[model samples]
Structure formats: structure tokens, C-alpha cells
Target: MAFNGKYELESQENFEQLMKALGLSDEVIKKYKDLGNIVEFVQNGNSFQTSYNYGSKVITNEFTIGQESEFVLFTGHRVKAFAKLEGENKLVITMEGMMAAMELSGDKMIETLTNGEITVKKIRKKI
Candidate 1:
């Protein structure tokens, strides 16, 4: 699950496709991309850091994910963000519970969702 290499256009497209497949509208896709590059770090004691990039502006924050209540919590300098997946739905839980459905195309879906740099034409699903 480690992200290797630089971000590429193809990788971005893959990520976009993952979002679309996950039932995210064009608006949501735009906003997620606009949210910029997200870097996640896991540390001691169920604590984690998620750094988000907004163009030239970068915001680094910390929080805990998968430690409480099916939510990914992020606390930043000026704002807090959280996300979650419930059933077929994905949500920005902390921000007024904005939700969308999850769509699974393949492992490329995960690469896209994480904004990974690899361009995978097909991904195998494990049953």
C-alpha cells in the first residue's frame, strides 16, 4: 500500500475513474481533486497524519482513522475533515455527513482512490 514514484496524468485519470465508479458525482470528483494531493502517515498509538495540498498551499494535520466509529478523522490547522464508508456509500462524515455510494471497478479503483501513481489497466478482486 506504499505509494511509489511521482504522480502521473494516467494515474490521476485512474483515480478519477475510481471516484466515478464509486458513485461520486462530477462535482464531488472536482472537489476531491481540488483538495489536492493527500499524504497519509501512521504513527504510534493509533495516531496518524494526513497532509492535504491545495495548490501552492499545503496543510498538514493529524488524527486517528479506523480507531473510532467507522470514520477517518483529520484535524488540520484551520479545519477538520473526516470520511467513511458504509455499505455501498462513502461519506465525508465530519463535514455534515455528505455521502455517496461506493463503486468497485477493480484494484485500479484503489490506486485511483488513493491518488497513487501507478497506471493499472486491470486489478484483480479477491473473493
Candidate 2:
């Protein structure tokens, strides 16, 4: 089961909590809430790229699994993340205090993220 494909955002849950935990301002948060964010992913084997568009702002990253990879945030903050496979199709990603569990099933990809107190869920479909 190769996950080398592209995916589009379908739905999300607890977005506000995650954004708040990320230290986004009320004005920016409201803007994102009003217009919504668009997320796209391109995966090729253990390496993956994700792009998030919030109207005027965009964040993109490319990283590999089980290795320390550097990435830049939309705000220009540089950080590192280590993504590891839990089993056959589950990817566990750790960055700072944040954790994301990504489950792959055929054409569907579901990701659940948490920052200790805040949680967010995103569902996407291959496109």
C-alpha cells in the first residue's frame, strides 16, 4: 500500500482550539474561521510535503519519516519534526509538544493532532 499520491482537504474538527493553542490572534483566527484553511498533501514514500493556505498566508514543508527534518512556519519560525510509522499505515509525528496521528486507508487519510490540551481532526481524500 503505497501512499504516494495527492490529497485534498475534506473536513476538519476542533480547528479553533488548535489555532488558539498555536498563539494565533483573534483577528487572524476570525479571518481563518470565516474563510477556512485549505490543506493539500503530496506524499512519496517516506517523504511528504504539506501545504496550508489561509487566504493570504501559506505554509509549506517537506520532510522524511524517522529523521529530524527542519521546516518553516507561516510566521517564519524554523522548527524540526520527526515523523515515524507506527505500523503499516499509521504515521506518528512529533514536533515540540504537538503530536499527530495519521491513519491511511486506501483513498482516505485521517489525521488527529493534539498539543496536550488542544485537539484537532482533519479528514482528507485522495485527489
Candidate 2's TM-score reads: 0.79
Query: Per-candidate TM vs. native?
Result: 0.33, 0.79
Error of model 2, residue 95, in angstroms = 0.6
**Candidate 2 — which residues are off by over 4 angstroms?**
34-40, 56-58
For candidate 1, lDDT tens digit of each residue in 8-116?
1222345457556546778866766535444333334444444445556655555454433333322121433454433431212243223322223332223323323
TM-score of 1: 0.33
Clashing pairs in 2: none
RMSD of 2: 2.5
Write one digit per residue (lDDT tens) for candidate 2, span 1-127. Answer: 5556666668888978887889988886677663424566677878888787767777888888878988776556787888888777888878877888878888888889899878888887877
Highest TM-score model number: 2
Model 2 alpha-carbon miss at residue 38, Å: 5.0
